[model samples]
Target chain A: MIAALLESFAAAARGLPLTLAIWGAGVATGLALGFVIGAVRFFAPAALSWPLAAVVEAVRGVPFLVQCFLLYFGGPFIGIDLTPIVAGWVALSVYGAAYFSEVFRAGFMAVPPGHLEAARMLGIPRNQAVLRIMLPMMALAVLPSLANLAVILIKETAILSIITVPELTFRVQGVGSATFAFAETTLVLALVYWALVEATAVASRHAERRIARALAA
Target chain B: MSAPILSVRALERRVGDVEILRRIDLDVMPGEAIGVIGPSGSGKSSLLRCIAGLDEVSGGAVMVEGRQTRPGDGAVGMVFQQFNLWPHLTARENVALALKLVRRMPAADAAAKADAALARVGLGALGGRKPAALSGGQQQRVAIARTLAMEPRVLLFDEPTAALDPELTTEVLDVIRDLAAAGTTMLVVSHEMGFIARLSTRVVFLDHGVVVQAAPPAALFGAQAEPRVRSFLQTYLDRVAWARDA
Candidate 1:
């Protein structure tokens, strides 16, 4: 049993870097795309906003796992063949962006309209007002929600293994099949995810306190 | 004698089918302070907003210092009832932000000017605090300092003391009173009867979005006042007396 556990652990460790790579890339791209989506939905005119809204709703309504399959498998039929890793990354980023946009849009609405008016009255440039005043206010108002989405994105990366991406779940599953240590491998995998999520929460709390102190000072 | 520092010509503000203000004309000479008083929804705030170019006029013009003014024209500064300071920023940063962004001042220079402006409002030592950390009065004073640092051609106040307690209102009024004494051109929309009476060079009473009476404080508040103006003052006095008796 110890031998089986060690083998499972080794396999899981081998897949760790790839899992983290996909998650980090997904988050980086998702955040950039999501910010644009949210701003357009909130501030753009109806002609431009409606189409983006439809796309966001369609992406959000679909299950992320199905999106992974549709992109990885169905792409070749449409002359857009993507490798498993590329397919998984794209699917995950788009999925995460859809949800993250909602969080940002809500945060935008939560900020006081008076703040922007004050900025404009003071002669601050429009772009500066949005960047320096509006975005920071929205981010501060919705920090916890953004952090929560980030944690959720990390876990969602596990689903990427279904498309044959060699991530933690894929490696652990291989170990389970080879050594028949399904229970041991799966248990360790659960613990790994739990640790990552807990770390994210603690780091979020630390960042929040630092920001509060900066604001007060 | 000097050209009017600010001019509003036939200002009209219509929201959908409702005409909130119509054909309002006003002028403020250099060193003159105008007090605007009226009942709620009589377009008192709208007039100030129009002059500051913060709100669009349906059919009118706002010219400050001989140029047509628009938002971000840097022609006017406004202090709001809520003292709309960015809650995340310190008082000094609040005062310096526009200077850095709009005036394109060096950060260090802007900081120095901000500190000086804060000192002018008697908040010299409290510039490091955020709005949340200060009293309602201090926050408004910081707001005044922020606007003063910009040195706009005209200053606009829309119910600057309405959000404060009586004690807190006194501190904000003191700052405005000083500004008036220094001959700053200003248009104040206020309910503080005593402050407006004492500080305004001329008082403009608005009703139903038009100027009902415009005169010096002595005439506007004296026994020989406009009947509409007298009734308005009477209503205010009645409320004060009722509150005291209660």
Candidate 2:
């Protein structure tokens, strides 16, 4: 069983690069989209905010797996075609973005009005105030939730296996079936995911501490 | 001779149907210190905020240095009751940010001026500390330093020491006293009657968004003043005396 597990690990390791790529790209795209949409929700004029809120609400209301299926399998009807990996990227990013936007909005709302009011009274320009005063302060409050979203995205990458993306889960399933070592292969996959989530949590905790200290100073 | 450095003519502020301030007229000349005194919700801070252009006035214009100024115009600066220093910036950066943004001073020059401002507030040694690390009084002083670095034509302080402990209040008040002595134009809205009595060249007493009286403290505090003003003072003095005894 040990030797079989080692073989499964080696096979799964080949899938690590692609898995990380999807996760990284998805998180980056998601965070960027989330920030923009969240800002619209938080500070944009009412006319602009309502529509953006509708879009965010629609995306979040659907299940992640269904969204992935619609993007990957449902695209041909609309004459929009994407490769399995690209579809996986879009699906996870959109899903993650829906959650991230809410987190960012909450963070912005959490900021005391006094901070921005002071900035205005000091004659700081609006753009500079948002960048220097609002966003950084919001990040200090929202970062842990963002880190959690990254972990969720990392796991969500597994769903891409159904679309024939050769991610960790896909490769692990292949190894398990070929060798009939389902138990060992599954165990290794779980351990790998556990490690990833743990790393994310630990890193975010350290970031939180550093930010708290800086804010306290 | 010249127009008052900062002037508010017939200012009115309304939120929905509620009137926060009404037909308020105030003129602040160079080297003059005017204290605004009133009970809570008497439009004291509202008047200050309008003069600073922090809030929109439904009617009337605020003229800074004899011309209308808008928000972010850098003509006026205000210190808040809560010492609204930006938490992320250090003391030096907090002061320097205004200089850099409003005055368009070069970074090096801004930093030097920030240091000078901090020193003026007796916080030169703590310039590197963030507001959260400082005491409440120190934080308010940093806020004052930030406004000073802008070199605004008039500084409006909205209950500047309201959030401080009695001991801390003096530390912040001392900085204001220095500024007042140096002939800085100021409009202060405060509940600290003693400070108002000591520092104001003229004091305006407000009630229900109306100026009850605008006079020197001696004129307003004595039995010779209007009955309402005298009554308010008597009540305020009694509260202060009770607080002291407690």
Candidate 3:
């Protein structure tokens, strides 16, 4: 069992690049879309904000796995010939974007009314005020939340294995099926994921401490 | 006589269902410092907000230097009650941000101007520090520096030292007095009777969103005061005196 666990760990390590690629692509796309959605929600009129809110609510209510499966298996019927990897990336990006938008919106709301008033009284244009004064403050406020989202995105990459994307989880499953060593392979995969989460948590803690010190100064 | 730097005529404002300010008429001449005094929630801050073009006036106009403030035109600078310095920006950067973003001043020139403004507010050495690094009085000075860098024709201050300790309050008030001495056209909303007494050329007393009296600070606080004004001043003076003692 020890030997089987070591072999499974090696297989998973071989798929690290694929795992990282999915996570990277998904986060990049999600962040872009999230900024747009968050801005629209913040500045749009009630008529617009309500519909956007409904869309965000609907997306958040659904399970991510179901969304991935629907996109990967159902795309062919719509005449969009997406490979399983492409489908998984697109699904995860869309799902993650919805969650990220809410996070950004909350950060934007945290900015005080007085800051904006000060900018206006200085004769700063509204758009310029938002770019210079508001965005930087929002970025600092949202950094911790973004770091947590990064960890979630990394773990969610494991779900892409359901679409046969040949990631860490997929390699673990393949090794288990080949050698009939389910317990060892699954345990090793769990350990790998635990290690990844632990590393992410440590990085986030360091980032928060840095931010706190900066704020204190 | 020279034209007033800021003029407001019959300004009316309503927030949701409640009227916040009503029939507010004011004219501030160049180089004059006007003190606005009232009880809490008497709409002094709201009136200042309207004059600074930070709030919409439901039924009046604010004119600065003969140009009426519209949605796009920039005219006035304001210092808030809470010292709204951009937390992420250093003192110099916070002041420079307005010059760069609004006036489109050259980066070096804006930085120089920001430094000068900070120096004027007695915060020359603290220019590199962020608001979180500064004490409350220091932050208020930075806020004043930011407004001064804008070089607006009219400067509006909303309860500038309301949130500071007495010692810190004196620091902020000193900067404001210096601005007045330099002939900046200022409208200050404050509860500090001493500041109003020493700095104001004229004092406007407001109550329930209306001006009850407009006179020289001495006259308003003297035996010539209206009955309501005298009653209000008595309560205000007593409270401030007690606060100082405590």
Q: Which is better, 1 or 2, measured by lDDT?
A: 1
Estimate candidate 2's alpha-carbon lDDT, on a 0 to 1 scale.
0.88
lDDT of 3 by residue, A18-75 (tens): 8878888998898888888888899889898888888888789988888888788877
Cα lDDT of model 1 by residue, A1-217, tens digit = 7877788778888988898899889988898898889999999999999998998999988888888888988889999898888888898889988988889999999988888889999988888988888877777877778778988998998999999999988998898988888889888899888887898779878987787566444
lDDT per residue as tens, model 1, B1-246 = 788889888999999998989899888999899999989999999888888777778998888888998876778999998898998889999999999998999999999999999999999999888888999999999999999999988999999999999999999999999998998999999999988999999999999998889999999989768999999999877887998999
Badly placed stretches (over 4 Å) of model 1 are A1-6, A179-181, A211-217, B242-246
Could you give candidate 2's per-residue lDDT for residues B119-199 as a string of tens digits? 999999999998878999999999999888877888889999989899999999999999999999899999888898999
TM-score of chain B of each: 0.96, 0.94, 0.94
DockQ of each: 0.67, 0.67, 0.58
lDDT of 3 by residue, B1-110 (tens): 98888888999999898998989898889999999998889999889888877788899888888788853255677888898888888899998987887678999999
- The 10 consecutive residues of candidate 2 chain B with the worst lDDT sum are B220-229
Question: lDDT of model 1 at residue A128?
Answer: 91
Q: Model 3, stretches more than 4 Å misplaced?
A: A204-217, B71-74, B239-246
